[model samples]
Target: MKGLALFAVAFTGALLLYATGDFPDWGSLDSPANGGELSTHYIKEVRKETEVPNIVTAVLADYRGFDTMFETVVVFVAGIAIIAVLRDFGNGSRGYPPALANNLPEEPDLIVTQTCNLVIPVLQIFALYVLAHGHHSPGGGFQGGVMLGASYILIALANGVEAAMKILSERKILLMAATGILIYSGTGLVCLLLGENFLDYHVLSRILPTDPIMARSHAMLFVETGVAFTVTAVMFSIYANLATRGTLKGGL
Candidate 1:
């Protein structure tokens, strides 16, 4: 009763807040966000510094890359936490059947299975394309990685957890996550070795004869790849644990 009353009050407050004009208009070209203080400066400075056609990608990868690095680490840590909590503590046997262990339905719909079979491959390809072309577009490492992980989930649902796990073994997922972090952090450390600030791409250009803009673009690509790898592995690890109901099934 008290909880229900609280929920009602909270819902009412949310409705009131929505009534206020606090949210920005969708895609308003003349609005301050599109033409105002921050956008004005970003438009002027981003092209001059990064020479990338996609302003959002440039901001995320170059201007505020340190923040992006920490965000990636956060996702990695969340994966580790889920794995630790959900790992089977029992005997060596595949812990439990998916339906019995997870309290999930034994059978899924045919439509879902057929749709997943059709869509998963396309999603995988799209994720890779997004990661590869992030510098020239709105899509980037985080979005691409999530999409990749979603593709794996679709496969797991369409086929089975055991089948998905066979393809993406636990050992491989751990190695991929670790490697992603290492690649990102190692790049920064390499910059430090070259007598520049960590993640400094200007120093990279000195060694490669590429222009500064190109150097930065290359660095962003490397970092994005690392992020995509970690995110994809971590998300799959999470789905595996949940689908198996915290059981360490040898297959899934």
Candidate 2:
């Protein structure tokens, strides 16, 4: 029976890998991706409609904003899961102290540390720039949010997880994650209440007639900011938990 199960598993894995043969070639410039109906339509219409140079950004933030909203929720849920699993560990009395205080050797080399320190600030600034210019370019909430998370991870790797957690407290991270979900959901609900489709920014403009586009832009910005904040915090929290072999004391 065990041999049969193993054979079945291997067969299934091989079959799944074989299925990829039907997929588009890895990077064919003339492939369907470059000339398909959907891609062609987006290529033509995206710039005209969203006025964004980055079609991917326009699609994620505007054309398919609803999908992005749900993606943010997924990230938020993952954060919550990490927090719940580790909450007990942060009993206020037991946790790994900061590396510097713990007297761990300063990571055995300074070059990587110095390089990361210099690059991290620039990366963070670029991440924010990407978020802000998403309306005009190829970056947006999801990409920007992940970049933000990466920035913190770089910091944690440089200084230490404890330092990262100090900069962003676990309690605060939990609250922010919850807040991001709430804000995304609440925006949709508010639109529904206003008699427009859920997340209809046009309807929101009626309340602020003088600056409808601005209002829409602001709402999107806020939503993205929430996403970035939650993602960055949650990622660090995960790193802290994993690095310590799930022995860290702080609650998720």
Candidate 3:
């Protein structure tokens, strides 16, 4: 059995390496992607079709929305998996390993805590700005969510996990994560209900106070906001669980 498995792995690796031989040369102008009408159409017509200035954002939130939505789902699932694997619901202290048990200080450091306090608010505000302006700028939902989650993590590191939990409780984290996916799916569902294909943002023009092109841009922002919500919640939740060994109490 072991020899058969090894042979299978070797065969698969050889097959993949052989397949790569057919790939186009680096930066070849006649490459399928470079020579195709697809890239040309996206570059020339994306702004006119969606009114989203950032071509990448337009492609992610409008052209390839289903793929992006599933990517967010994958992130949420990973967070949930960590919680499932590590969380301990039973009452009372399970006791920490020797490395962690004696390391906690009696009190948080004054300078570190104060610095985090000063920085956290500003960090969170910038995160929101990134989420809102993603269609026009380089920043977006994933980047903003990471920043928001990092602020909570900074609180945990400076003052301990308990302080961070006060702001984002375990229940709140789960709710926020689920809500983000709901917001993304619900937008697509709205489009479907309006007699259009899923994620067809142009259909939103009927309800929104805008034309079709602007509606696509607006819908992209909405989905990006949803992505931000889930990412922010899941980011903090994963940290809180790991730091406290899933008890969500009394850890840095």
Which candidate leads the pack in lDDT? 3
Ranking by lDDT: 3, 1, 2
**How well does model 1 score by local distance difference test?**
0.82
Better by TM-score, candidate 3 or 2:
3
Q: What is the lDDT of residue 240 in candidate 2?
A: 71
| lDDT value, residue 179 of candidate 3 | 98
What do the candidate models score in CA lDDT, each in turn?
0.82, 0.71, 0.91
Clashes within 3 Å, all models in order: 0, 2, 0
Worst 10 residues of 3 by lDDT: 89-98
Listed in order, each prediction's TM-score against the native is 0.79, 0.71, 0.87
lDDT of 2 by residue, 139-243 (tens): 766677678878877777777766677777677777877787777778778878999888776567767653555556656666677667667667766777666
lDDT of 1 by residue, 1-252 (tens): 999999999999999988867666777788766778877877788777778888898888777888988898998999999977777667476644455344545566688888988898899999999999998877989989989989988788777777787888888888888888888888787779989898886677877679877888788888889899999999998998876666645333
Cα RMSD of predicted structure 1: 4.6
Candidate 1 vs 3: which has more lDDT: 3
